[model samples]
Target: TKQLNFLLPDSDATVAFGKRLAPALKQGAVIYLYGDLGAGKTTFSRGVVQGLGHNGNVKSPTYTLVESYQFSEQSVFHFDLYRLADPEELEFMGVRDYFADNNVSLIEWPQRGEGFLPEADLTVSLAYEGEARQLTMTAKNVRGIAILAALKS
Candidate 1:
């Protein structure tokens, strides 16, 4: 329920934050990414995947809407809803299935799929502050708060 704010000096700092967060993640966790266009959502997701032991390229699922990765220990789903015409489209895409007990989901523009997506454990909001970024991590559940604590430590 507490919000933690971190001043990221650059895009690299944001990526580093994501890298620090990835190893602490567990299955069934949901991360909501909120920001305007070109806010480094995809860049952060790349760091997350790399930190999770993934050695492949990470790209935004803008047109496709969702990108899935199957790891040795867990699965990660990246969702970009900017192209979504309606929230109901999530139902047709079986969005609920991605939030099951075995997966961790990172969603961008979550407002597009409000009711269809599961509640986020963590919400990371990125804003451009001059040339740098200000990142605010808000915990919506116990798991998220734990992760934030770990990041702080």
Candidate 2:
């Protein structure tokens, strides 16, 4: 998969990108988010959830690990593996259940859960560059490619 580079001038731009990305999401899609703490992962997720018609407070699953949302049209599971002690804990927590039919999974710190987590359709890496942020999005599969295409148009 090739990487698509995007420049986010500020936190608002990152959030806007997520909002635009939400409508392109499909069932069974997995999105892996890579970034450092305070890099706006939660902010982006909030926009995505809002774009998906979820009008509530969106918080990081730092303690809970995963937050599952059941909407009228789709189900979304947001996972934050920052607090994970081991990838094996995922199985014990029944992480597979979240990947069931018609669900879209958004994962943060996926590297911590490497072997336990499923392959991501899309992988977005965010990094701070000066006063701006750099977002590199890569599509690992056809579904993700379609999402990139949609985002472009």
Candidate 3:
């Protein structure tokens, strides 16, 4: 596993980090976002989606569960499982199908869908640090390692 840690001074810094992160990812990348409410997980994801070529609005799918953006080469799926009462709820939603090739899944509250969700390529944990935010990213597979290494360079 590979890990990278950084401090984001503000929302803009987090967005910048996410924009920089977008290039290192590709299709089938599953990124689990862990953070408390208002910790900027959605803000980071918005940056990633916009950086990946989505021109429309990017908002937390808190009530919708998932929101998808279609791109020429890749599709980005944002999921918020905070409202989920059971992991099995994902199975009924055909969660597996959403992770198909050419798809990038950014899952928030991933713990809520543990058993149904596939292993994440990367895990991003955010914490409040003063008025800023701290990001701790873990690469779980070869693909994730490449991403972290690329970001390092």
Candidate 1 structure quality by residue, lDDT tens digits, 1-153: 368888888888878878888877864579999999988888888888788878878888999999999887789999999999999999998877778785789999999998898888999898989878788889998888887777777
Clashes of each: 0, 0, 0
Residues 53-116 of candidate 2: C-alpha lDDT, one tens digit per residue = 7888888899999998888877998999999999999999998888876688889999999999
TM, every model: 0.94, 0.94, 0.95
**Model 3 backbone overlap count:** 0
Candidate 1 residue spans exceeding 4 A from truth: none
RMSD of each: 1.3, 1.4, 1.2
Candidate 3 Cα RMSD (Å): 1.2
lDDT of 3 by residue, 1-153 (tens): 399899999999998898888888764589999999999999999999988878788988999999999888888889999999999999998878888876899999999998899899999999999889999999999888988987888
Off by over 4 Å in 2: none
Best by TM-score: 3
Better of 1 and 2 by lDDT: 2
Error of 2 at 102 (Å): 2.6
- Residue 144, candidate 1: Cα error in Å is 1.5
Give residue 114's lDDT in candidate 3 (0 to 100): 86
